[model samples]
Target: MFYISCTYKIMATFLYKCRDVGYDCGFEFSAHSRDDLMPRIRIHSRYAHNIYEMTDEMKKKVEEAIKQID
Candidate 1:
């Protein structure tokens, strides 16, 4: 007889430096995934930069700058 157990570990931590994309807001965002960080950034941008909406290209830029952190 043989017994087997299956388990998986998910690493859910990433670091997104605001300055990476050439923004000097002095803000850094960390989240389980990039999908989670975007909204926070958008809100921050709204209050900090007074930008109500982000362009598609800007969003792409942000996605590109995200780096996983352990």
Candidate 2:
């Protein structure tokens, strides 16, 4: 007799929308994890919105705005 095992992986897509953070801009970003999405958001905030630094409040807002979809 022989036995076999199979494994499956599910990936969650993390999404962030600028509007969710009170921005009127229609910028949307998606990544596999928050770690990956934040850097891109930081760059966009600096270049597009002239946000040189992310305040603790802003970081909390951003984190709350992130949505995860599987």
Which candidate number has the best TM-score? 2
For model 2, name the residue pairs that clash: none
Lowest-sum lDDT 10-residue window in model 1: 16-25
lDDT of 2 by residue, 1-70 (tens): 8989989897899999999999999999999999999999999999989999999999999999999988
Q: Could you tell me every candidate's TM-score relative to the true structure?
A: 0.76, 0.88
Best by lDDT: 2
Query: Every model's Cα RMSD, please?
Result: 3.0, 2.1
**Candidate 1, residues 1-70: lDDT per residue as tens digits?**
9999989898779888778878886898899988898888888878987879888888887888889977
